[model samples]
Target: MAFDYDQYIRGGKLPHIWCPGCTYGIVFKSILRVVDTLKLNRDDIAMVSGIGCASRLPGYVDFNTLHTTHGRALPFATGIKLSKPDKHVLVVSGDGDATAIGGNHFIHACRRNIDITMLVFNNFIYGMTGGQHSPTTPSGHLASTMPYGNVDPSFNIPELAKGAGASFVARGTAYHAAGLDKLISGAVQHKGFSVVEIINACPTTHGRRNKFKSPTDMLLWMKDTFLPAVAFDKLPAEKTAGKFPMGVLFKKEGAPEYCETYYGLVERLKKQREGRA
Candidate 1:
């Protein structure tokens, strides 16, 4: 029997507004599957997002959701996590929203190792803002702002998250739907900061400009380019240079969670004050 997806989505928000061929829907479904498999209570989950195409997800999902300012999703989610450490907080953001505008927040969140799961929809271009060149747009890619071809280098999101001290780091693509669900589940279960970057295609913008005749072509590219970590590890450097490896990339245990540490410090300060009095 097929699972009822409507249980998680808002009844009034049927027929989402994403463009045809956009793979954000696939990633969203993966998230729902993870939620179902984990059996997490909807009331205990808080979904937050910054302004962008991907940011609209929280509005459509039935949960405690926050649509925050551009580049500020992480900080807002941080406050939520700090206040109610028992609640699970999730952030959904696009490449531009996460890496370009919210870059500082993203890194800092990782540094603190706060318990929040962030899923970045990396479609290479800024799909919401007229397909401009985003921080993750590949070099030589075409965008509305870079009609002549993108000259700026793109960011390797997984590496950045690991460097910033994220306890869990993983990569998934929309084409690999099952893999995305697994990665998202792992990220959510982790006790510290976790980042899962899902590679998707902005068919309307990135595809047309890049000569991908259709959105399916872009997805096929993802299916071919991204490989399982074990298989990817066997390839030569030149052969694997541009390919993305799927599955968990990094995970560290025993790091003290930020909110727990903060609360402990508060308790210590209170005790000291009481002793002095």
Candidate 2:
């Protein structure tokens, strides 16, 4: 049976703003499929995002959504998760929005181990904001701000999330649309801070500047470069030099979720007050 996307999509919001050959639409559909498979209630989900092309996603989804200031999506989502601990809070962010200006929040959110799922769209460039070099931009990559090629080393987002105490960390690419659905579903079901760094293509900016013949070429690169986690682990180190692993790279069970701990404290205080009375 064909899945009815109309129920999940916002009315009259079609003609999305993404450029031709952009893969955000594929990512968006993968997310929707995950939500449907989970049998999630739209009313019980809250999607939040900051300023970026990826951040525009929440506006098109029929859920409780927030489009906030640049680099502040985590903080806002944190608040929602803390206040309504039962709700499934998700954040959609870009490479620049998640790891550049929002870098501090990204790590701290992991440190706190909050129950929020963050999907980072890592196109390696600031696709919406003049094609600047983002923190994830590979060294020697071209961007509007680095026409001579970027000098800074790029961040490995999954490793960074693991180092910062995220209980769940995974990665997927736009080319592996089916795999992305599984990765996102796992992140959403995880009880503590979960980060899914989605490798994406920005043909208009990053691709054109970096000499990718077309978006198809960029996607093919993803298909070739990223290996499934099990397959990736079996390869010899030298053979895996330019490749990356997909699927859940790290997961720590039994970590205390931030909201649960805070609400537990509140309940304990209430009991103390009752004893005083």
Candidate 3:
């Protein structure tokens, strides 16, 4: 049976701003599928996003949503999670919005092991902002700011998240729609900070500049390049070159979630005050 996307989408929010052949829509639908599979109530879900093409996603969803300032989605979502710990908080961000200006917050959120799911849409270029180079932009990639080809090193998002202490870290590509749904569902169901970096294509801004003839070419590249985690591990290093592992790249079970610890302390303090009274 076809999933009823209309139930989750906000009314009159269609005619999405994404360009033709953009894979952000695929990522969005994957998220909706995860929500549906979990049987999550829209009222109990808080979706937050910062300024960027990917950040516009929250506006189209019927869940409690916050469109925040550029690179500040994590901070806003952190607040929401801390205040209403029972609510499921999810943050959507672009590569730049998650790693460049928001780098500090991103690392700290992982360090805290907060119970928030962060979905990073990495198209390599700043699609909404004139194809500027982002932190995840591959070295030697051409962008508006790097018309001569970028020399800066790109971030390995999964490694960064795992190193910073995220309890769950995963990677998925828009090309692997079904696998993406599983990755997202796992991330959402995880107990602590979860980061899922979705590799998608921005045909209009990034693809044309990179000489990708069409969006299909970009997706096909992803299909050929990304391997499932177990398969990636079994391959020889030489064969794995230029290829990345999809699925859950890292997961640290039994880590302490931030809100639980914080609220526990608050309850203990209240108990102490009651004892004095």
Give one digit per residue, the lDDT tens place, for model 1 in 196-231.
999999999899999899998999999899999889
User: Model 3 off-target regions past 4 Å?
Assistant: none
TM-score between candidate 2 and the true structure: 0.98
- How far out, in Å, is residue 187 in model 3? 0.9
Clashes of each: 0, 0, 0
Error of 3 at 48 (Å): 0.3
lDDT of residue 274 for candidate 2:
100
Predicted candidate 3 versus true structure: per-residue lDDT over 1-277, tens digit per residue: 8899999999999978999999999999999999999999989999999999999999999999999999999999998999999999999999999999899999999999999999999999899988999998888889999989998899999999999999999999999998998999999999999999999999898889888999999999999999999999999999999999999999999999999999999999999999999
- What would the TM-scores of all predictions be? 0.96, 0.98, 0.98
Query: Which residue pairs in candidate 3 have backbone atoms (N, alpha carbon, C) closer than 3 angstroms, thus clashing?
Result: none
- State the weakest 10-residue window (summed lDDT) of model 2: 1-10
Give the total clashing residue pairs for model 3: 0
**lDDT agreement of model 2 with the native:** 0.96
Per-residue lDDT for 216 in model 2? 99
As for candidate 2, its clashing pairs are none
